[model samples]
Target: MEFAKPLPNYLVTRYHGWKATSYQENKGWYRRLATEGQRPRAMVISCCDSRVHVTSIFGADQGEFFIHRNIANLVPPYQPDGDHHGTSATVEYAVTALQVSHLIVLGHSQCGGVQGCIDMCKGHAPQLEEKTSFVGRWMDILKPKYQLVQDIEDEEQQARQLERQSVVASLENLMTFPFVDEKVRDGSLSLHGLWTDIGEGGLECYDPKLELFTKV
Candidate 1:
C-alpha cells in the first residue's frame, strides 16, 4: 500500500495554527468582523494565487483590509443578470457595505491567466470550446488589455507593460459599479494599481509621471 502523507501538513497546518494564535491574541477582532460592521480603510483586489496573499503582503490584522481574489484578479463590468460574479459581489460589499475609502488592484508578474491571454492574442492558444477550461474563461477578461500592450516594441518591455496595464484594466472595471463611480467622483474613494514582481521581491506602483511601474 502506498501511504499518502497528510494534505494539511505542509501549508494548512501552519496557516491554521496562525489563525488560532491570531484569534487568541486578538479576541474580539473576528467577533466584531463577523457582525457585518466593517470599517476597513482599504479594499484590495488580488489574485487567487496562493503566493499572492493579501493579508501577508500588507501585513494586515484579521479585519484590516477587505479583500477579493479571483483568477488573475480580473474584475468584469457590473451587471445585474445574476451571474457568478464573486468579484463583482465583493466589490459591491466593499464599496457599498463597508464603505472603504481606497481600493487597489494588485497584479503580479508572470500570471498564468494573463500569459494564456497573451498566447491567445498571439494565436498560440485555442479559442473558446466546450473543452475550454476555467482558466480559459477567466483569461478572456484580459483579451483587450493584452492586445493594447502588444502595440509597444521590445519583447521584454511588452510583457512588463501588459502586466501593468492589466492591473489598470481591472481597476477601471471597478468603476463600472455605480457606487464606486459615485464615490470616486466625489473624492471619497481613490483607485490605485499595484504590481508585485515575484522574481524580484519588489512591489511596484503605476507611476503616472513615467507612465510605467516603479518599485516601491
Candidate 2:
C-alpha cells in the first residue's frame, strides 16, 4: 500500500503539467461538456492501455467519443451474468442512450492483454477457472482469434495477425447486443475495426474481403 503514494505524487506533478495549458484555454468547453450534454456520434471500444489512446490519436476533443476501454478491447458474447458485461452496457448506452451511428472496436499492436490471451490458449498461462484473474477471464474472449492466427511462421507477423483477428472477434461480439443487431439490420448502425501500430504510426482498416487489416 505504501507504493500507492507514488501515484498521488505522479498526478500532482505530471498530470497538472499536462492539464494546465488545456484547462486555462478550454475551461468553458470542459464545463459545457461536463454539465450540459454529450452528443458523441461515435462509440469507441478500445484497450485500457495508456499508449493506445483513441481520442488523442483521432484528434477528438471531449464529448466527441463515448469511450469504453477494457482488456484487449474485447467484447464478449451477450450472456446473462457472464462476468464480461461492461461491453454490453457500453454498447447499449451508445445505441439506446446516445444513439451513436458508428461503433468502433479499436485494436492495436504489442497488446499485453492480447498476448496474455495467446499465452493462455497455448497452455503457457494458467487455465481459466472461477478463481482466474480478471485479465485471464477477460482475455478468454480472444482465445478463438488467437487460435486462428497460430499457424503463421513469422513471430512478428503472427502477433499482428492475432491482434487483427481479435478485432474481428470483438466486432462480431458487438452485434450480440440486441440494440446493435436491430440497428444494423435497420441500416442505422455501423461497426468498424481498426488496428493501430503505435511504433510505426500506421493505422489499418479491416477488409472484409481479404479478412485482413489493410493500411489506411
Clashes of 2: 0
Write model 2 residue lDDT over 56-116, tens digit each, in one string: 8899988999999988888888786755466787778889999998999899999888778
**Local distance difference test values of all predictions, in order:** 0.81, 0.84
What C-alpha lDDT does candidate 1 achieve relative to the native structure? Answer: 0.81
lDDT of 2 at 32: 92
* Clash count, one per candidate: 0, 0
Task: Report residue 152 deviation for candidate 1 (angstroms).
Answer: 5.1
Q: Give the TM-score of candidate 2.
A: 0.89
Q: Predict model 2's lDDT versus the native.
A: 0.84
List candidate 2 stretches off by more than 4 Å. 1-7, 14-20, 81-84, 127-130
